[model samples]
Target chain A: MQYGFFQVLRQVELAPEHFVIWGRLTPPPHQPILPGSFLHLKVDPPGDYRMLWRPYSFLDYQPDTHQAAIYYRVVGEGTGQLCQRREGELLPAIYPLGTPFTHEGVSRAIMVAGGVGVAPLLMLYDRMRHSSPQLRVEFLFGARSGRDLVPGLLEEFGVVARMASEDGTLGHRGYITDLLPEVLEQGEWQMVYACGPNPMLSALADLLPEGLPCQVSLELPMACAIGVCNGCNLPLRSDGGRYPRRLCVEGPVMDLREVDFAALV
Target chain B: MGGSSAAQTAEGFSLEVSLGPLRLSSPLIGASGCVAFGEEYRRLYENSRQAMEGSSIAQLGAIVTKAVSLKPRGGNPPPRVAETPAGLLNSIGLQNPGLDHFLAELAPRLSQLGTKVIVNLVGDTAQEFAELASILSQKTDFPAFELDLSCPNVEEGGRSFAMSLPSLREVISRVRQVTDRFLIAKLAPNVCDIGEFAQAAVEAGADALTVANTWIGMVVDVERRTSRIGRTTGGVSGPAIRPLTMALVHRVRQAVRVPILASGGAVRTQDVLEYLIVGASAVQIGTGLWIDPMCPLKINRGLREYLARHRMSLGELIGSFQAEVSRGG
Candidate 1:
């Protein structure tokens, strides 16, 4: 439940504001880090102002090396401080919390990401390849500009990457939602997994075809990253009503149909 | 401390605690609101088998459902909760499936649990509380009710009734007319003197008391220069609020004769013991269950081990450590 020595093994600057850091954990020998699950790190130089733990989803995992990476955006003081840390420094973490993405009985999958929301999707990509190579995967990445995209990461996984930027500097000029119509028409995606800004997710929810399976990863200010805090809750539409369901316990990855996007915001 | 004492008869392990007419199987009960209507964690109860199975109905010592209202409420805006130091802040805006829906949907689910569900009722007015209690009492499945007097009076422009004794007493008295089911009044931490409110609720026929709910707190988004929670202010719960909960529980226990169910910061067996020593009949694990799903099982096991080691039954320890207040020690 609690991990003490999961230090940052390597840090790669993906963009000006976004950075990818690989944390090499000394997990109890036989234990393996699964994709979609996250780690809660105790912020060093603890003070009254910044005492709570920070959570980051596992972006990629290498079981042979015992290293896991997280993609984080410098959004707050805690993340800004985390971004500044160099390699070899020790950071205490509580890991692999919550349920992971279900990879069984899937022949093809489509992954959608926006900004730092791409983190979990990348992990899913790797895990699917290793777990079931027959699983065909494609990724659609949306960012503000072409510079924000993580160059050939999707291509390395043999995934067809579709780039969309807000500005006309990349593939599609408008939102990721603009391309959804065309993507659905081209291929039969068995399952659709998306993680991005709320607006993009809402748009996708509306555009999604019926009977096709879809799941989304949401972001919330997490304290314990475990279920107790009740900090992360996403409203789910059930039987024509909405209820605030705990995201950490019930799900961090929920079926799209079950989620009430209108109730969430 | 004889190994085969005649006093330790064939009941296995039993402790009788009273909450008005209702006699609990043991002093250990789940806190209201923390555990859902008992049906929510049915899978967990099934998984743990019967060792961890507390009565879904009366298993909680008494069940406290999440805050309910007269009509269905949609609750607050997005980003309803955020993490705090040793705590969590939530602006759930009291999102409930409405009284009618609960009566129809949730009541059946709760009834199947085989435990008395203590509906944690909340409203903006005394009339509303009375109406809710009246409707709940009429239902065949409904067993007991706990008026959440601590809810911030949004209708009165955001003033909590639990902060004032007279206001809380009036609500309890109004609900008493409709329901003979045991009434437990839950208190709020946003008050100067909780003893005043506790005495008033007891006088107004409240059978028991839930020590406290979340305290008002806020987290700021420095970049946007705005609060992180959708509703700028929220109730703070978890380990950060445990010590304060203990103080209130201890004070209320001294002030009133009604049984007190200690909530707030109970995450471990030691914390539960601390509350019990201070005169709490049972302790509720709130935020602790969020961290470790098996916390209640762990705490229950630990308490059993503690009681066995002390060579004392739970009844012998209840309110046995009270300290009389004198001019000096």
Candidate 2:
């Protein structure tokens, strides 16, 4: 983990209330920036809003040049304030936090994302593409409506893309689950990765083929993004045993089957 | 950030604290639950700029592990924590990996950390408490045991043992027989007289006392028309309960001779200094640590400045607060 102030090179409005914050972060020497990891942005809310810094996922990172970016949505006062910052501002951050998504010797993988949840998966795809260019990959991106979809980052990724929107303005006219079944039927995917709001992740977890392996990035209201807080707990179950796992260290990305979806709101 | 600082004071005063056989480099501890036994925060410390600044987790006096038990507890169901004004209501329910898993997996790494380890133990019965103590007594690495008496006394119809004199004595006495290590009985603050509970545990051979645990609190999400926590009520911690706990520390100081390890709402160095003034030999940082992993380091830095500014030693401040100040004419 690295704690330092990174200069904001640019901030792009991905969609309504959504943004991709680009920071000039060059890690120390020989440090590997992994996928599904996050950085805590200490956005000092101007007034008495009661929130400290907040956590956002690494949208994409370049190892050679050592540049990193974070994706965020204006959910509350904390994040809403962060989106208002201009470029060239120094943003304090704690980086490469939580566990990363690993390729686990799979020849093929499927990714399911909802809105800003697509952030980490993009980085995962970006990094994995280097090692396994021929590795078959499919991306299922979803949003509330047409205006909310990120413009063209998907087309530039150069992979099979499947899109969905609830308002029916985008690719498939329904929830992401509407497209998941057909995507599952398309190939013998070795692994599945998902990230999004709680209900969406839960629905995807429930919709997956039982025997297939899947990983999910869990989100909980947080304070200190570090493991010390014990605040963000995702109750999990595997092999009939149920327990709570802190998202900070154990995972932000966890096995989909292990998550006890019913345990969280 | 500074060339001149309190942590750099060169004088006769020292921040070190000694309570029975356990010695602490400073009075602040990484309260259980907020900090993992030690390893996780150690990584955070290592990653932090404080490492280059010449500060580390080693500066903390000790660490109390989250409540461990004889059997593994999965913890409370959904919504284990709820945020209140400058505090939180938590119902973690002492979730742990059980004795065998802890000793085999986490204990080895925890002992290796260059800080004192005070294992917090919780059980349903006095015998259960003693069994944990007996088991831990054999572990040479751990220097102390903190009895989490906030748990329900199943032997006495579900009221917390810390709330009843007899139950408190029975549990403390039973654990005392098995462990020669420093025994700290953590009492609760909700009862009518916290001092009475403090005295009872000491009489039963408690080496020290953790002044009080979280206060009983309930927060309702009125719009949703439901309890905030999955458990209807949970323990309230942070600045909300600091004053109430400070008073309890003062009362416990007057009632007993054992050192008091103050818990509950402590977020700042002033809170720690105040607790020491009210007779706490040490202070534990819980909800605050959850808010920031670097709290102990920040507080210690502030404490060194405080000691230097006042030109006083920590021992001079212990129980030094004069509640009834005389007005000079």
lDDT of each: 0.71, 0.78
Model 1: residues with Cα > 4 Å off, grouped in runs: A1-110, A119-138, A142-193, A199-215, A221-265, B1-16, B48-62, B114-116, B141-143, B153-155, B322-329
The model with the greatest TM-score is: 2
lDDT of 1 by residue, A110-208 (tens): 888997788788888877877786877767889888777766555545556788999968888878778777778777789998888877888888988
TM-score of the candidate numbered 2?
0.87
Residue B187 accuracy (lDDT) in model 2: 92
Per-residue lDDT for B51 in model 2? 30
Candidate 1 per-residue C-alpha lDDT over B4-63 given as tens digits, one digit per residue, 9 for 90 to 100 = 221232444554466666565545555555665665454443433322333122334445
Score candidate 1 by TM-score against the native.
0.71
Model 2 Cα lDDT, one tens digit per residue, B146-250: 999974212237578888899899999999988788899999887888878888898999999997888888899898888987777888888788888888998
What does candidate 2's lDDT look like per residue over A105-143, in tens digits? 766899988888888888888777888867788888888
What TM-score, computed on C-alpha atoms, does each candidate reach? 0.71, 0.87
Give the worst 10-residue stretch by lDDT in candidate 2 chain B: B1-10
Q: How far off is residue A49 in model 1, in Å?
A: 20
